[model samples]
Target: MKNILTLSLVTLSLTACVNRDNQYDYIETPQPNQVADLQDDDTDGVINARDLCVATPDESEINNEGCGIIITSSNERHLHILFSNDSADIQPIFSSQIRQMVEFLELYPETSIEIQGYASKVGNEEYNLALSKRRAEAVDRRIESMGIAADRVTVVGYGETHLEYDGDDEMSHARNRKVTASVVGYQGDIKKEWTIFSRLPK
Candidate 1:
């Protein structure tokens, strides 16, 4: 009878140990909440993408698929430097404007510009084309001379094309003969006002 009782007690202890091990084997570890971790709270069709400007105001103008807006208030990014007849030289009066542009490019190292040169309808198409190219190159050289990298500037000659004013007047021809500098590949939010170019003192 004593041996039987001792054996029964041993069997009960072993069964308890087995039950404890089984319980531990079936236990589950905590997992991360994937739904809670998801971004894009505003749901403006833009994800948590860092390349674009996010969380823009509802009333603000957005373009380029919510990246930024076209700044039209100031011509800081787009400048028109008028030229004399049959001349590719940048006048001294426009030096202040070019300097301001140079300063802006210096501030934003990643920004690049396109210098588009134009000519009046007074000359032949081929001659005007070459003249416009020279004008573009002149502006490009000026920008490069101001310590800006040559690679950042692109020269384009659009002779007698996209005329700002179309008329048989001197003012129209003068307006057509110009070089426009436009900033490209700017990856920043469009502000209300850009840096204005200060005119040089007379």
Candidate 2:
């Protein structure tokens, strides 16, 4: 009788273990953010393979992948400001763009920017290169004055290398006298740029 009792207990323990295993299998699993569902075609969870924004930025609506594409609108695209013939003084019109970029950078923990300068084909290669470098430095100084860290900017002057126009005329030269600002590094919660996040059923 004792042997039978022991056997019965063992059987019950085995059954309990199996039940626990089954329960674990049914437990709800955590899902990634912003993935879309193709089976249901309308469900949203994490940004998945079919997600349209393949280059989906990793950030909130405001913090895109260092690209600053989230806070900026496609219709009103931000362009680099052009400098005067030999100066880096930013025109008043570029103030709004500067403000926008500054605001965006402030949200990240660490951020860096690159300023590149180009010159027209009018001057000799060496002269144009030197001029471009000065223009780039001028713009970098202006941005640094606005509270961004000086060490974070990689100032470089290509000197007419990235010219937008080919000729030495005013129109072509005008295109070459420009400074471009590019964000290089930033740290923060910047993930899931494209996806329906609200429709999840929990």
Candidate 3:
């Protein structure tokens, strides 16, 4: 009877101690400010709260922040062809430019360009529009002769609508007669350009 009484008391004391410690040491779990399952709008595999770049490009390898780590760059694809007044003939001085067009077309077979032709602001708008168009076609013909398909190069005459030099003076007018273009292509979803450089004989 005496041993039974002592065991009961000891058990009660242990239970009391445990309850007291639990009351002091126990902590509640913290709740988040946002919902746990927000949408990944960019499909970058990261949720909005954790993603620093929310609109990451598709298929770009992303970090925890959902931004691309693949470093990329862009090169200028500007094309310019200067012309003598009233002449649609491409000068011999632009041989380098012609090669540039040919090589670029060969490399990216699917790419195409629209040659925008411009004339000096001093000429008649109607007449200049026609002249500019001829200039654009002249470039197309040159490129077409070099072996790029006719379908790959399109031409448009903007005339003096968008001028490099917006003045009616002689020098400024001379500066405005030109054909220009830019070329671009996509291997996957990435836009790409190439610059073919040649070393001139010193």
The models' CA-based lDDT, in order, is: 0.77, 0.65, 0.80
Can you list the residue pairs that collide in candidate 3? none
Q: Model 3 compared with the native: what TM-score? A: 0.55
Q: Which candidate is the best by lDDT?
A: 3
Inter-residue clash pairs, candidate 1: none
Q: What TM-score, computed on C-alpha atoms, does each candidate reach?
A: 0.55, 0.51, 0.55
Residue 121 error for model 3, in Å?
A: 1.7
| Candidates 1 and 2 compared by lDDT, better number | 1
| Residue-by-residue lDDT tens digits, candidate 3, 6-123 | 9999988767746544654456899878756578888878987788887776656677787776544333355788999888899999868977978877877778888899998775
Q: What is the per-residue lDDT of model 1 for residues 1-202, given as tens digits with 9 covering 90 to 100?
A: 9999999999887677556446523457789665532355445445554326667654455554555464533234666899999999989998888888898888678888989999999879889999998999998888899899998888999999778888989999999999988664343545432325535569
Candidate 3 local Cα displacement, residue 36, angstroms: 37
Model 2 stretches astray by more than 4 angstroms: 1-79, 184-202
Q: Model 1, which residues run further than 4 Å from truth?
A: 1-76, 184-202
